[model samples]
Target: MSKFSFPFFFIVLLVGSSCKEERQNDTAENFTEFVNPFIGTGGHGHTFPGATAPFGMVQPSPDNGTTGWDWCSGYHITDSIISGFGQLHLSGTGIGDLADLLLMPTGKTLDVSLFGTTRDSLPYTSRFSHSSEIASPGYYKVNLESNNIQVELTANEYVSFHKYTYQNTNEPSFVIDLGYAVNWDTPTESSITLESETQIVGYRHSTGWAKNQKVFFVVETSEPIVSSQFMANSETLDSKNEAKGIKTGGQFFFDQDSTKTVEIKIAVSSVSIANAKENLISRGNSISFDEVKSQTNNKWEALLSKIKIETPQDSLKTIFYTALYHTQIAPVLFSDVNGEFRLQNDSIDSTQDWNAYSTLSLWDTFRAENPLLNILQPERANDIVQSMLAYYDEQGRLPVWTLYGNETNTMTGNHGVSVITDTYLKGIRGYNVDKAYEAVRNTMMGDIRGLAPYKKYGYIPYTELDESVTISLEFAYNDWCVAQIAKDLGKEEDYKYFSNRSKAYKYLFDTDTGFMRGKSGDGKSWNEPFDPKFSSHREHTDYTEGNAWQHSWFVLHDVPGFIELHGGNQTFTKKLEQLFTESSEISGENVSADISGLIGQYAHGNEPSHHIAYMFNSAKEPWKTQYWVRQILDTQYTQQPEGLSGNEDCGQMSAWYVFSSLGLYPMNPASAQYEFGSPLFEKATIAISDTKNFTIIAENTSPINKYIQAVKLNGESLQRTYITHTELMTGGTLEFEMGPDPNKNWGI
Candidate 1:
């Protein structure tokens, strides 16, 4: 072929590839997979520095975090050394466990301590040198100092792929602990049954946050193993259930090692072994690495497109987009090709037809994540509601921090009801609404552990429930969300009932103290010397991973009502300011590190405070919201490894950024309205749908110029606490002039 022919041929191939990718139904120009997975590796960020497609089932990365804390999602920024990457990790949870299904690559014997940490036992670890590691959001590469091996990791819907370069071909050998498990750190059973030279079905089962989680796997090796070991616990699995689990692995050998690559694909199901087998078999061994990588890249594109934010500051874009990526990564697509899934109830095989989802970090996501999903990707929102409804149908109630098919019920309060109710209210589809109503009511009014404390005490009363003050406040807001949802669905009785239930928080309010205090089980009594910051009985109440100062503003559904609770708009505004800058002197409980964007007592780091900035619209002053929103956009967020100052909280943290940057936030998610907030970009363009596009053009908009001088919708002056979904979806221009100083009287 002539040189010109080769060039023309290459262009044709590129165009053809682009056309083929277009078939996946994702926007292309918007996605850049250059995310550094190692960004959050330091700090108690709990992120695995690994590579995976946006929202894919696989999270292939090194499992460097062995601290067994909630932050160990991947490797900790504070750790001194590296550990092999694990396939699956639970996201942003308070409990430490389930670093299940690990994959390690080596050029020599794996000398690292499987137990994690050496004899000196540093109280806290030193930061990992950045020179030793590299990460982008969708992919990660790390070099182990001890082994001198370069390890790369990536993930797709349910499979993890790894590439390792050994220092020397002869010294290279890898390890797979069929017996490995995490934080409920004891493995009850493990076995590696060699199915053949190239395939192995390994199994291991142990107890952790999800008790009695039986893990079974069928791993097909890309190469043959020269040496492999099978280690099982002294105990054996109940013979009857042996077909289902008891962890095991398959190791392959090579005649001699060079820079050979080992790819291990895995699928985890709450359902059956056969389904897992089908899941594995569906992706035949002949598939190319680039094909899988491309599939993941495109998926990332679609997810990233769901919310697009462009800015002059590249760092802001990285932070905004990365946070956006993190939110959609979990509660992933849980169904297989035939729609087989692990049912809500563990016995499995019940639903070989529909869909099932697990790993719902509801308490955190119920605030921002689900609402964000409802607004942007309503279709997926519907499926998530249906999945939770299915949980209620099969498990008998809406889940409380559900994992795998089991209910760890880790967090306090029932917020998934809010997710269901919020989605349903928005006229979103893909769920059985009536069934969802049933589940919502059951969870709200049913006989769960926290209900009596909720119903009888208005909020969980101290005399009635230990975390009385904390539980009462949060329950009240969620109660309102549920009731609002019920009312929208025309469940009149439920509407009235839950509406009253939501007001239960009023009882806990100590007008004299001007704080939410614990009430006694008896109608007239209250906790003595009430300090909102302190936990009553060390129970996870009076705070859902927060303090009374933090929980005081939990009522985002009815911000006006929350203002009313504070006496009036003026007083409420004063307290609101105090909250943003509130300092904790007592230091009651050890709080999560992600709760760091402090404005006095207000915490922008976690979900509870996500809606706080918009509360300004409810007050006589909207400028404060402008001030803090700009401060957060400029400072709390950056395009660096530790870009986010708080928990990704499954994406709530990032969703908050995405919405804020777009000059809008779901001030009231169920209300089908977006509250205007400070815009971070000079010009933000949102393509709401194929035919509808929206743009925000700021006049003198910048980090210093934070206030909105004025507002206009399409060309008309607009003054409203909220914007309608109609106006937004109509896709028009929202223009504003901003300044560093608050234009306090402008919006008011």
Candidate 2:
């Protein structure tokens, strides 16, 4: 036997013996200790280091600015100043919105003269250093240098709990600002009312990415209010307890003490102030901040323990756990404690049977994040499908991108279809299958986002739309997802029709240039002066966030056909090799900033190129997939604030890292298949279900021994390069023998 085989066999025996007991106590592992919440807060990652529960409705974090792309999450690592701490925040998004219910605790009174001025001139701002800041999965703490106050934040599902400690100051006041808005967000109307001596209720209606957004909040303080000053648009209101206008806020004075600590809790709802109050009450007003903090920590621990990895490298463990943490921050709870949620038409729905969710970044997440959720969080996946169906019922079509209760219509394609289809195909049937099929079918058949032109012309014409080729490719993939459900439902005619529509990508392919180029309305000629590396941001371009080279390989449903389009295996493999070896420079005066994490022309930062590396498996070059996947794993991610290469895009970037590091990826997200890459750990176990566990063991796996030499599934030799979702969930052991060089003949 080889030197590595004895330990591998011994581990297999131990895992097989203890599998059932481990499943019973999966949460016994403290996986949250490995998570670093600030890994993506710097560079262009656009993630916030905040305090939030898993899929919680509230994300309370400090805001540094209201302008600039770096402040999309309201907090960046480079910033030193803090405007205030807001109740709602977006994580790793390209567009910014929802920094509502801003609260600032100060030692001195605010200047009423600067009420209507820009946020930068506000006197309540404070400066803090990174050395004095600390962040983890469910908590954040910072010492404000301006007032010598230390702030700590924690949260539950719908409520944010704040603790402030004042030192060396006599005056202790609080400012409740309803007029605070961040990038892409503008306060259309707001109001604040002091309901009691220690209670406040208000609402903020804004217009931004999600038009006509509504946020109702209820705040409760441990200390009673002594005095109050309400203002609107730089003018003090006549009413001492209330303020209502486009710009509204208030300054409230509490009991003065030299050294004091105050606790505040803020609950929010999309339905009404009454619902927000009920949500706050449901958490028990007397619950201590430390108790809530401990609860949130336990929640995170249970979720993060779903997949336990054994690796010698601590940095890899941190990166893996942090990536996993980011995936659960969104698709947050939208329903109140009383099962009340707002609809897209601004109507309240009080009969929600399941927990409603929002912040669906489907355009980016359907590729990897949703797939990961299916494996780790199958029940939440069902709720996500139900949420999409609810949106379809509220609107005529499914959500492209939604926040809170409104659809932003951001990005392209109805990728909610992909999420629903993937969920159902994975044997999760907590939703109505027929209704999901109808929703996807109607969405693709409808006339929106160039779908009418795509249906009529087999391709969206460049003359009619900006991202014609990109839309056609993405729509084709979604259509494939629709066809899968049709086939499953035994609708033969519908399946055949949609299956043909799924090939709409062929209409945009240019055999002469070997790229997916844009064609005119008449379909007579390609767009002129075409360069594969050229990119433009939402301008006269045929791509969305990428160029021809990146978008051309997006045929996830038909990779074999895509390879054939490039003239068979050898030629296609050569062209694929060139994608990473070509020049990294882009040829455009105004290129999309989304195209980042560039290794030559392969942009790992964006979603378009996420599955391109795995296409080598279809071209019969699995070794190249292993090589490139390892390269991306080593180079594109790290354990620092500036670790990520591009926007987290609501966890899609991190999801890519999580899946790729595990030696598998969902090349076709809805296909329920995972292609193997290079596994990073020696042993990784997944809690497949209540009583079952799936374990993957890689022997002699190190930086030098990166290539897979052989593989076994339950002690039998495996030949295929991919594994099915059914095979994975069946709970068996997948063992791989690692060597220094690629054994190209092993998987083939």
The candidate that wins on TM-score is: 2
Candidate 2 Cα deviation (angstroms), residue 690: 3.1
Error of 1 at 13 (Å): 40
lDDT of 2: 0.87
Question: Model 2: clashing residue pairs?
Answer: none
Q: Which candidate is the best by lDDT?
A: 2
- Report the C-alpha lDDT of model 2 over 576-648, residue by residue, as the tens digit: 8899999999999989999999988999889999998888888888889989999999999987677899999
Summed over model 1, clashes come to 48
Model 2 RMSD, rounded to 1 decimal: 6.4
**Could you estimate the TM-score for every candidate?**
0.87, 0.95
Which lDDT values do the candidates have, in the order given?
Answer: 0.63, 0.87
**Model 1 regions lying over 4 Å from their true place:** 1-30, 108-129, 234-252, 257-259, 349-355, 532-541, 582-584, 589-595
